[model samples]
Target: MHETRTIADLALEVRSKNAGPFWVTMELFMRDAVGYTIVADPAYLNASTVARLYGIDADTVQIFRLPALHVVKISFPRPVSQGSLRDRDIHAGQHHVPLALFPLPSP
Candidate 1:
C-alpha cells in the first residue's frame, strides 16, 4: 500500500506571514525538484484550490513558481485588514496549516 503524503511531508518548510497590512503570503519550500513539481502543478495546487481552502476569490490568489529554487510562493489579499477588530491572525502565521495539511492528489 502506498503511504499518503501531505504538503508538509514533501516540503522542507511551509510558512505563512503577513505580506503587508492587507495581504498574506505563504511559501512552500519543497525538499527537492520532484516535490516542487508536485506542489507547483496546477492540478494539485491551483488558484481554485487555494480559493476553496482560504475562502478567497480565485482571481485574487497569485502563485509564483520558482522551479530553480524548488519553492512555491502564494499571496492573496487578507479577508480582513491586519489588526482589524475582525481579524484573528495579526501576523497570519498559522494560516499555512490548512494548505500544509492538505492531501496531495493521488498519482
Candidate 2:
C-alpha cells in the first residue's frame, strides 16, 4: 500500500508571512533536491492550485522556483489589507496551512 505524502511531510520547513500590506508570501523548504523537484513542479503546485486553495484569482499567484536553495516560494494578493478590520491574520502566518496539508500527486 502506498502512503500518501503531503507537502508538510516533504518539507523541512513550511511558512507564510506578510510580503507587505497587500500580499502574502509562503516558502516551502524541501528536505532534498528530490523533494524540491516535487514541490516545484507546476503541475503539483501552480497558480491554479493556489487559486483554488485560497479562493483567489490564479493570475494573482506567483510561484518562484529556487533549485539552489531547494525551496519553492509563492506569493499572492491578500484578500484584505494587513491590520485592516477584515484582516484575521495580520502577519499572514497561518496562511500556509492549506498548502502544507495538501497531498502530493500520486506517481
Candidate 3:
C-alpha cells in the first residue's frame, strides 16, 4: 500500500514532530531526479530511523549504486564485504532508478 504523506512532508515532519524513530516512510521517485535525492541521502541515515521503520539495524542495510535496471554492488562497511542486489531496481520507466537496502552478509 502507498503512504499518505509525501516524501518531503515526511522528512520535514520527522524533524519537527520527532515522531519517534520507527516511523519512516520509504519513498519512490523518478530515476532522473537530481541533486541530493532521498535515495542518496538515506545512504547515510541514522540508526534510530532504521530501527523505527523496518525493525532492522541501519548498519545492516547495505546501500549501493547500480548500473543496469536489475542489479547493484552492495557494500558492507563492517565485518563482511559486498554483494549484489538483484531485480529490485525494476522500475516502470527508464528515466528513474531505485535505491534499495537489504541485509548485510553474515561474517
Candidate 4:
C-alpha cells in the first residue's frame, strides 16, 4: 500500500535535507512555521513554484529541511547579479520556467 504524508512532513524533510534541494526564503519558511503552529494545516509546495512566486530563478532552488530561523542561502552565477534578478522586470507574454519537483516519502 502507498503511504501519504502531510505538507508539514515534507516541509520538515526539506528543512532537514533528508529529501533534496529546494529554494526557499526566510519569509516563506516563517509563514509555514507560523501557519502550522496556528492552524496545523499543510499545503503542497515545490521549490520552483515558491521561487517563481518570489521572483527567484529556478537554478537557485535547493532542497533541504531548513530551520525556520535559518537564513535563506541564495547564490547566483558570477555574471548574474542577485540584486538585478530581484529588480528584473518580467517581459510581456512571460511564462513560468520549468523546474523538477523533488519527491517525498510516504507518510
Residue 87 displacement (Å), model 3? 22
TM-score of each: 0.95, 0.96, 0.28, 0.26
Off by over 4 Å in 4: 1-34, 37-43, 67-107
lDDT tens readout by residue for model 4, 1-107: 75543333323322321111221222123235543332222233445544654466656655334445532322222222323454242221111112112233333
Candidate 4's clash total is: 13
What tens digits encode model 3's per-residue C-alpha lDDT throughout 7-74? 33322211111112222223332233332243344444334444444445666544444323212222
Ten residues in sequence with the least summed lDDT for candidate 1: 1-10
In candidate 1, which residue ranges exceed 4 Å CA deviation? 1-3
For model 1, residues 1-107, the per-residue Cα lDDT tens digits are 88888999999999999999999999999999999988999888999999999999999999999999999999999999999999999999999999999998887
How accurate locally is residue 55 in candidate 4, as Cα lDDT from 0 to 100?
A: 65
Which parts of model 2 are misplaced by more than 4 Å? 1-3
Task: Using TM-score as the measure, name the better of candidate 1 and candidate 2.
Answer: 2
What lDDT would candidate 2 get against the real structure?
Answer: 0.95
Q: In order, what lDDT does every prediction score?
A: 0.96, 0.95, 0.30, 0.32
Q: How many backbone collisions does model 1 have?
A: 0
